[model samples]
Target: MRSRRARVAVIGVVVGLVTLAGGCASTDDPKANPSPPAGGIEGTVWVANEGGHSLSVIDAASSTVVTTIEGIEGPHNVQVGPDGSRVYVVSGHASTVAALDATTYRLASAAPTGASPAHVVLTPDGQRTYVTNYDAGTVSVYRPDLTPSGTIDLGGGPHGMRPSPDGSTLVVANLKAGTVDLIDTRTDRKVAAVPVGGPAVQVAVSPDSRYAYASVSRPPSVVKIDLQTRVVAGRAEVPTAPAQVYLTPDGRSLLSADQGSKDKPGTALSVIDTATMTPAGSIATGSGPHGVVIDPTGRRAWVTNVYDSTVSVIDLPTRTTVATINMGSQPNGISYAPRPPAPAEPRMSVVLPSPPAESSHGDHGGHG
Candidate 1:
């Protein structure tokens, strides 16, 4: 759906591979106001780096980086807007969706979508903003202060997307038509599709969203769906191409992130166990593993290899990997904001760039 380049030639390998995971993440509630104190981290994680066309803000207590925000180009997935103060990024070479300002990182508006947005979803009272559009299958939506609010035509290659923690529904995955669609967020329409597997690149739910997972990158499985009888209730192989599935702020467990076997690229990380959803172990990490966060004290988990630019971290009760952190280029998407970056000034403008040399790489809408 997109590939024009020059977002820093590919911001260190497409922002470490479009990472994302947030249905709510904070941890040690001393009343909860953690992060940023160690060095930096007042909410903001959209990394993609793609060699630095833009997007970098790190500071998660000195993880570093802290600044870098430009429009969008080869960007890929990154979300945080919905009143958390904006961040939505998704640009496979400017198909468009920028909208920054997660506290002065800057930019603030872009929109255009419908070719390769690849992923984005919001509406827990942040108003609305869907995006998706992999190669023009379509999805647009908008309005959390950005406007638009229209488009919706999916099928074929939509990539991993979620929304159902009682928000009404909006699931989508459609990778090459393996299928998922399901829309309806209060009558935006569509309503059904459901197939799954063989391609489904990422999708997660379960904090009472009633279950809905999907990771299938060609037989390297993890399908399970049931969101109120939409169907396809089974599947679970994961080890190779399962590119992202997050969920575990207590919802039990379901982490996956495989990126392996593209000629043994394998680095692993599986983990399942959602009350017997199966496959409870795998670990290893760091090679090309693309996106899979978990900080607010879920014990640990950072992952973001994208061809070893580095980031493993992990630990979570001995899942392993302990520390890696090299983070330079090709490190796709990853986000977090238990709180940290609003001391005034910075409002958004972090520019880091200088990596690119790696390479690159969602979902939503329609059913009728």
Candidate 2:
């Protein structure tokens, strides 16, 4: 097995190819592309720059970085409120979750957590937030004010988590324990635990919230769990070392960012048909594609290339990459917040001269 440093070296080589193949050609001349406006754009893509210790907010429409928020240490994951009024970030190194104002990107509040908080998800009602504590082997629950509401103990390595569509349940993937835990939101307790093959890393819930697809790293497969039955329903073979799984808005398709193996680190995203429970296709992406998110319109999907420090924008309809966005070091976690609508265009008032008032015959008589 290659050491961690050696793996990084290999990733760097792959990233070089990504830049060349994906047309991410870099230039030193800053004038080539001007900076975007300071104000955040509606439907923005927020990326956690783990190595840079910052959050990069990108304008989805323009495909440009709108702003970079600094001082966040090891921001592993991010989530935006349903109404797009608040943004939450989980800092693994800092062991805290920071809540930020959606408009100004200013720190609103922060809640302490156990060691190595890996990911966060918000309830559908936007009243509560749940965070996965990787090292602590528990899930931390928080209120909107960033106050601790409760905590649910779980198996070792509670890493990735997502709330059910209806906000009735929370699904957590335990890496070390190699199991998936389901928690009842109403009762605030673990309802079920399903043993996946091994090292379940990330999960994505279906649109109806009836099923959850989890990426298992050990055997390299996506396991589908029936939420109602709380049992393993099926599995789909993906590329080796699937790192993250995401379901499109319609929930008809599932996308997996396969991290590949020691011999072959994945440089592609696998597309699966949820109905058929089979691999439909694959879209070539940059090396180390870690985070995946779809736009509100469901027209495009943004994927973060960790090793390349870039984001690949894939046109959903075409299933082809449309653009590559350059980012800071090791861009990993990403979330999409619909840009607030632009203020209505100022109403313009125009005074037009009234039509010659019924002067047809009268004007003729005056002329005579």
Cα lDDT, all candidates: 0.63, 0.72
For residues 10-37, write the lDDT of model 1, one tens digit per residue: 3213222322221012121112222223
**Which segments of candidate 1 are over 4 A away from where they belong?**
1-44, 47-58, 62-76, 79-96, 101-103, 112-155, 160-197, 202-218, 221-268, 271-281, 284-368
What would the per-residue lDDT of candidate 2 be over residues 1-368, giving only the tens digit for each residue? 22222323432342211111122233211123244332223467888766666777776766666667777765768888788888888765556788877776778888777656778899999888999876567899998888899999995778788889999999998876888899999988998889997778889998898999998876778999998888888999876777778898899899998765323557889999988789999988887777898875667788977666677888888888777777766676889977742222111111112223221111000000
lDDT of 2 at 81: 79
- Reference-based TM-score, model 2: 0.82
Q: Which runs in model 2 stand beyond 4 Å of their true positions?
A: 1-42, 261-263, 340-368
Candidate No. with top lDDT:
2
lDDT of 2: 0.72
